[model samples]
Target: MPIIDNPIVLSDASLVLIEQKKATANFSHANWGDEDLQPVRREIREHYRNVQRLVCVYCLGSVSAHSAAGAPVEHIVPKSQHLHFMFEPENLCVICPDCNEFKSNRESLVNPVLTANRVNYPRNSALYRIVHPHFDSYDNHIAKFNRLYVECSDKGGYTIYICNLNRFFRRFGRCDELVNDVALAEQAERFFEDGIAPEQP
Candidate 1:
């Protein structure tokens, strides 16, 4: 994941709808009509896919519009927990299904009251306990080894733990087995090509 510029350009009607929802305290996605919700949903996915280069903002997982599990629009501050920011552009990001499912309604704010009082979207990453896609650069926190996630900062560590980044590695041995086998095959290839084998102890 990288710090991607938000490319979603909400239509005037959509903005009006958001404002109306805010005024009415009606932030439920299920309640919105197809005409209002569908376009916004489509635009969100399209723009984010382009801006994020089709990578999940949380785990850097590959996301494809054509995939069985397509990228989902995620609320950085869960809408359930922060209704005021339900439609805030900065609060929205695209994430993989697994990350989204695991992170449901999980709070990320360093201070809820401070975050809730923002007149405008906050730009300071320090305000958040987790890496905010809008406010923080992904590489600054997390280091990656193939599919393995390594935390370089507290935010990265928290994000990995909350999202269960190593879920596959923990639930199954296939990841390690596949990686080890690939390494072995590559090593054998190098030996065969060189017509030499290094001395083994």
Candidate 2:
């Protein structure tokens, strides 16, 4: 994982839809999974996927939007606890399904507070116990070795524990995936030269 610059700008239509949903749902959990919110979810997922180069934020695993079991928009702050950040762009990022499911609704920070009086979104990295995709760079806190996810800082360790990133690699062979990626890349090079496409795995 590396430092990712995510520029999540919502369209005017998206803003209007969000306001309508907020009014109807009264900022409840219902608003988070509303049918009208699918567009927003898609937008967030696509944006982060691009920014993260289609890799999982926690494990650096490959992800595909086309795959049925692909990346999901992860809430940095659990929406169940902090409903106010349900639609906050800075609170969202795309991570592989393994990380998403393992991290579901788990509090990853110490003294996690949502303040309305703040002038802008919280920018203090020290406030968060986990590695923040927006506030902290991944490489600065964690280092990866083949399939192993190792933490170099407290935040990195907290993130690994919350997401069960090491367990995910143990369960799913990341080395095998890397081999597959390399083979696919080689096949692509051959296809460009010989005009022959490889069969889908």
TM-score of each: 0.78, 0.77
Report per-prediction Cα RMSD to one decimal. 7.6, 9.1
Question: Whole-model lDDT for model 2 versus the true structure?
Answer: 0.73
Estimate, for each residue in 1-201, the C-alpha lDDT of model 1 and write its tens digit.
236775466889777766665455444644433465666667667777778877888878878766535787888887776766666778887888999899987888888886776767666788888989877877677655456666768998999999988787778756554357776556445654764332221
The CA lDDT of each predicted structure is 0.72, 0.73
Pairs with steric clashes in candidate 1: none
State the lDDT at 26 in candidate 1. 41
On TM-score, the candidate that comes out on top is: 1
